[model samples]
Target: MSEIKKIHMGPAKCAVDLGDGSERGEYVNQDYILNKLGRPHRAVSLMYCYYPLDETWPARARNAFKDKEITFQWDYPYDDYFTYKGGIGGTTDDEPFTCMRDVRRHGQDVILTMTIDPNVTDEHLEQIGKELSTFGRMQLRINHEATGNWFSFTKRATYQQVADFYIHAREVIKKFAPNVQTILCIGGVEHPEKGGEIEMEKEFADAVRATDIWSVDKYMALHWGWPFDVADEGGNSFGRSKVADTYNLTKLSEKRYRELCGGVKKPMVMSEFNADGDVTGPYEQAEMVKEFCDMLKNDKDQGWFNGFTFYQFRDRGRLGLEIEDPNNADCGIEQPVMQTYKEIIHDEYFYPEMKSEGDAQFPVKLRWGGSEDAEGIEIPLHFEKNPTFCEITFEDEDADLNLMMEINGKWFYKAPHAKTIDFMSAFFEKPLESEADMTLKIFAPPASGENVNDGSEDWMLNTYSTITKMPNIRIRFAPILK
Candidate 1:
């Protein structure tokens, strides 16, 4: 196999809608957001500012920087027909529009999204594109709905509008943020009102390729609600033979996503993904994060491309959580999910196999064996460090041995016979000195009463001797910390 490529792994910033920061009360405090965003392996914040022009917008922007937050701005275009509660929508008519300016003035990095609108004239788009280019690192947001009226677009509109929007947005962005990184398609169909949304996404992605930006999303979900709830429905199965809705959707989404963007040269991102604290069980949420990490690691192994982001940090008021004791309105830290992200960031044991010499010291032993008659045996061996030699002995006369060994949870060796072992004990040239766990598995074939199945009748295998830190084992050390 070829060498594995390492991709940028991090958490999404601003996992919630900032409504002027006032309605949030003390719940929307900086410390809370910081703790959540920084807890991930890679720190990021997801933001959907209602109106960048509002005075409060800059205050929010400033607060984000103070927390060292990575901003992902969800830009809603100019539309007079809609009234964004926090004075956000209709970008052209808004005044004091300094949100992006504040970010740049503060020397902060940001991801500006252009939520495509059909009514945007070529000149207007050109100007918007110029502003984005000047800002640099801006991402275009493509939605199935029309920004012109904030409603679902017709099939024809979905394709033509998105295709045209990308062509124009790309032309302008190429001139401005030429090195601009990602182009995200917001609101991937959970349940497309019209089935055409999926097809439209493909069209938009194809267009985005011409511009050189990677493709991604704002939010995507597989299962949307808690168990036994009315809103429970799964989205983005990712072509798994058996759909595990409880697992994080990012993995499944990315699998299907690669299929969708197969020929494209750019990577993708989950840009936004998470369950409402109230709806998802704590342990389930943590499991989802683990699944997300597993997906990334697996993708790295397979040589696929892209990145990922967890959705808004705190759940918006739209979703209600049943209070346990009611001490604080804040959902008491979404422990399971939060811890999962923390583990992903802080824990180095995500994959059992050790990649570097420092990690090899911890070896885990896996064991398995049994008689051919009816039952089997399995044992787990823990090692203080990597062993110089491993020996397996069988006591049962009719036992057929099938044994295997693994280092750091990865398969390393397998042997058919325990006795005729006349080989130099397999050892790591560089012996690990720290505690580790290795797994050994033994399988004894079942016996058929007749000779038609060979002489093997009753089979039984067991480990009689287990040792760590053998006398002849040599130690070589290279100081990792200077």
Candidate 2:
């Protein structure tokens, strides 16, 4: 394990919410955490540790991050929802300003998840606006997990009430923190009871309809703590979320969330995901993580998921899927799961360049050409080493391009297969012929009607170009080894 541990000395890579959201400096210790695992946390989420998401004590909180990104989440002392009271913190309203000021000095981005009760006063809303204005470019998720019954805002409020609150929050946050990224988040899907005041699916759908950037808290496990129906009905099962050895991505998935968002098109993240309670030995745990990560990596609707953070870094009671080497004899520095994670963090797709130091980047350059150049879409590709797979993305998906890529001699196809690619992205996993130069040809109906079976080919060719001028392409090389 010591030999395998890799150093994570890059910008924040987002592994958050460890151990009941406390501010104790235990997990924040870098040298100690590095010894236990291969690297330090790219992101650490501290939930409700400070009443106002306090970042005032830089000397104290800064060390925990060790220069990593910070995600601070907490419920405001807003007594907006008054039916059943939870311990609402006092007006630590000034805390965010203090905390964010310290975070800016840390030189990393921050994600702030703030919750307000139903009885939220105008003063409280105004304070939040000021905080965002002060914080600047943070990802602010208001009343996250709005679909769940746990939080005060969501528990008693009707779905309409939650939706209205979310709309208002977004408006307020934007008015102040023009640079802030407002996010809509929900607890994992739930069975919307018949005749219930809240319709989890409809409410979530409505919320995302208001904004494109959304977050969800989902765990891939054998016995899910929540209804499998939410997943089943939504027609989305992100890999092992259907439990071990099952994946039905088409019907229910992150796509369903995307579908609901309607038009706002920012990439989203699985703010909380992992095998939270899946009982597993070391190898099984490794497989679980590997499978799920692979699914996200290869998702045809690739852009829909920008990134994912394991449910937690340390542990919170029985839901403990701590990334750290554990105290139990069954877990150790030799744990296979940790090894898998170390390898995963090394992947460029996950950490990119500035986020991790796992591997040096292979240089890539692109030359521009008119849309009608060459056969289909002219794609030049080369992979000189192992793990040659890459993710191909487009800025527009308005056309039906049965895009096919010819690598070496064989061909690979992207989705929606023969159907239109409604989403703007897809994965390219064509195997490189053992380091030989590789070229990928992505074509809409061939410009030359030579391959056109009928007028449909000519029509399709003309149609794609007209749908949108050749769209922009973005590809991410896989950072991990095969």
Candidate 3:
């Protein structure tokens, strides 16, 4: 059992925003898609309003869970259905880009979002990297909620042009979709931690320089435990980590996006959230789904939290898709929050129980992708919810090459190319923790000649960050060419 891998935070990567007040009918209703595959967090989300009709939304997100281990979260529209009726090499009509090429040929994992045009430029981000350069692996989130005030391009893009278009659309997906893992999503509620959130956390740490994960889209209407202080430490519902919302908007934008990731702990996702505990009482959405799953199974913060999606999922017995808006009343599944989220998504702590042994250092801080630019990828490792022995290094120094890291076997090395992204990782000295098995690996090479993207630092590529934001699905290899 002491081979070197064991980590656990149990069950944290959950999702379900199929549709709330469906003006679209929860993607062609099949009982609103089996009430999201009837449970145990199979991950499901979609939204692609490019108009011109035909938003099958990746075949209704592969009809919920037909992809077996599905994990889809897609949202589109920065207005450019391939040049909205003709432009970037005009063509007219629509295709929704072949439904994102049939949602990557029968979807399995995704988290791509968009909505904030500010009349996007840079040649419409090189045609959004030629339409997201062959979606092999994704998690874009393009300029979403930049700093709030609701899009009109958030007051005309200027959070430094919305973090310089999130580092120029992740360097144009490293020249035509280097496996798209770009992220910089903000707006997790009115944001707070000091007036104007310390200058919007210094304009999101001076207009992005690195990213792949740092999401937020908070929500809370009738949350919990903080009536001034009757023993108020967020009032024990399960144990500690209290959660009560109305304005805390996902804990002040996840504590000001971890102070703008200065300490670079990358790997945090609440991508979009929800809460209503029945607007004050009445089974309060099943006690706000058991106090938001017991404050996310007792969060410890800085554990590099990953995925907690739950925006909408059928605002009621649809049966005519109800919508008179009372904050979408208990927002979704209804009736004691759908039987208390089917018994807290079949608890095991939500996902725990993969343990192997002990050492306790654990801080892989969730997965992140590759290519600072030079075209060389093979990203998509795991462990953000479970599995952690923590000790990761990578401050970027060109981030070297030929670095393959299998969960327990395949280990290839060659980082001496000098550049520094820092490395010191741990999840139990060096092996599985809580969760990470399908053999996670990382391999990169391709950047040469003038030493490619020598920006010197800024590499939190945390191996394309995704410590299980769903039922487990990792991908992104197709760059190591020349």
- Model 1 misplaced regions, further than 4 Å: 1-32, 35-108, 133-138, 144-156, 186-202, 211-264, 277-279, 298-302, 317-334, 347-482
Which 10-residue span in candidate 1 carries the lowest summed lDDT? 367-376
- Compose the digit string of candidate 1's lDDT tens values, residues 52-128: 43344324433433444322212112221122222223353331124433322221223443333444455544554
TM-score of each: 0.44, 0.50, 0.25
Ranking by TM-score: 2, 1, 3
Model 2 over residues 1-482: C-alpha lDDT tens digits? Answer: 01111111222232222221222112233223333433223333333321222233122233433455432211222211111111233343344333433333222234565666545655556656554443323566677667665454665478679888888767765774455666777643333233222236665566667764666666665323222223233343322445332233221444566555554565556665556333444466677778877775675755555655554445422233343344552332334555577667656556422211232211211111112121233334545544423444443443343343333332334333233222112222234345544344443322221122235523211223222333333333455566
lDDT of 2 at 62: 38
Candidate 1 lDDT (Cα, whole model)?
A: 0.34
Error of 3 at 71 (Å): 40
